[model samples]
Target: MTKHNNLQSISVRIAVKTPAVSRALEEIVSTLDGFEQQLDEKATQTDVLVLEVGDNPAKEFETVRALLEDGVVNQVFLTSAKTTTDILLPALRTGAKQFFQQPLVFQEVQQAFVDIHKERIAGEGIAVEKVSIKPGKMVSVLGAKGGVGTTTVAVNLAVSLNRLYPEKTIALVDMNRVLGEVTVFLDLQTEFNWDELVKNISRLDPAYLAKALIQSAPGLYVMPAPNSIESGSQVSSQVMKQVLETTKNSFDFVIVDAGTQVGASAFRIFSSSDTIALITTLSLPCIINVKRLLGTMRLLGSIPMNNINIIANRFEKKSAISLEDTEKMTGHSVYSTLPNDYQKTLEAINTGKPLVDVAKNSQLVKSLNKLAESLIVKEEPVVKRKSWFW
Candidate 1:
């Protein structure tokens, strides 16, 4: 219960159902100069609707949902004697922005008022104008299935880009949602993850994002996914969209390690990215899954065929399946093939070092550097180099 500074110029119109809650809100609103209160339950034009739930919280939640669906209220705040997760989760899913326990913490109420006031001011175009950002390109690396070297490609590509273009800002995001290993791959220890940022998504700005990022290298910032599986479900597609949009504005290049699962959030990331790198191996099971993934991407229609780059990982000079056969089977051309250097690759991962840093002269490292060069924008050339990987 921390008191927020009074917002003087902004006005809020609040309606309450319970008399005790009404008195508490009135006392809190009196602390601010321009805040208004409407006690009538029938009031239709109110900024916020404060509903107090009794014994039957489920029935009360239905009423809140109906008001939201009918557009009768812009925001909803709930108060109940029972503040358990069972009660709070439904209220949030039904569109309640904030919740308060009984007897009312005045500081929490005041902070909610402050947040709504800022939102109102933003809606009316009176707040500080958003900084015009020259957005960078976003690349999402998605694997067809597990253990397809998705994280390897994502980490190396990010490091290569950072080394190639020393002046430009680059960020790598681990969007695996559940059990992401980008931080582990890079051996980066971060105090915060994407979960913390999405929880306070409305407060997302460049300054806030800068603090959330962990600088794994000189110019490369890594935003790892949550360690716990439960935290992954907390992030929604809407939150993912906001996070990527903000990241695009802040960096010169953004790489997303979208893990194998193509859920709603991953789909949103794929739709928004400038490039979608589909990584797969040369096995029948992996090839079949690649075809299915390609069909799904076609159905989504957000990522064009040309923008989807099909990469073959752990490729060999003499394998059962050739690149031509892979292209024919998947119905997509292979963009590039990473060499099957198992021992070198394993050593790089075990030591938590990028390919370029540990084995700079290896064929696998050369292929990764070539892939990184292909991703760079021609107009913003770091150096005039020839393409040899193609």
Candidate 2:
């Protein structure tokens, strides 16, 4: 079933004075599963209110504005047949989320209501988390340049770690936004993505978050990036921080495919990460970019030199620019190197399986396993806290 199949209950009231518009609004609201139109206009509190501006729009606007400021209405949708800047500007000033100018588009109206329902469901999902928790470490995999095998490293490393510690829960999040290919790489279809999680951030707890993530392996879960470019814009660094914080508290480890993004979001990830695996290739141009990226990170001062681990991806022993040259340029020692196995790596990606899953004995998979092993810090057994009442 689709996520929007079961819409939660929402009380709607129409204050449209236009007979035709009111009937249209009523008809549309009735068709929606969870939206119930209230006949009693005297009711002060409602989940949603559709208001139409008439000859005296000023009075109606003031009433709705007051209703919003006083918390009498959660959402106010404005509709009017007359397209006037005077009406549109005031409607927006009142904090209306949507404005439908006469001859309402059916699809737009339905989509707006669906969005409201999703938000309400998300809000209601918020509750006190009663589960015991152990905070996990976050490993952010970032590419020095495009096509530097960031997702490859992240996906395989996550699978390798899950294979090593079958009991531990691992979350692989695609933070590359719309361009993310983690899901494609893993060949997993998910009902939810980062955008959905961010929308329901207030409801984030172990159970809610678990529902949003799709399990790929026995102990590995994946969260893909938003599907559309427009959806990607809705994600903010603050929301990402909250999501990551909640995720880390629930899982044993989080592997983020950050995909060469440098911005507030990237900085936030770097700041919160236990390890920042900077992926680079054994080439002149890519190494130069890596050096610049390292310099930029140092200038920002959000990431420490020790926390940043530069892993040289697609390394060849006969390459002109060796690991030593890379170290000399970046001023940071190479954390680890994965052998250049182009054919095998491409085959694994094409098959939508991690290297460990497809070719368990390959040198690339072995190197990834070693990297995962070094990242695994043995934690002491979690002790349950006794209640004061006990």
Per-residue lDDT, model 1, residue 5, is 46
Q: List model 1 lDDT by residue over 41-90, tens digit each.
A: 56555667777777788888898888888877777877777756577546
My TM-score estimates for the predictions, one after another, are 0.66, 0.65
Model 2 segments more than 4 A misplaced: 1-132, 379-390
The lDDT values for all models are 0.79, 0.81
Best by TM-score: 1
The 10 consecutive residues of candidate 1 with the worst lDDT sum are 381-390
Candidate 1 whole-model C-alpha lDDT, 0 to 1: 0.79
Q: Point out where model 1 deviates above 4 Å.
A: 1-131, 380-390
lDDT of 1 at 210: 55
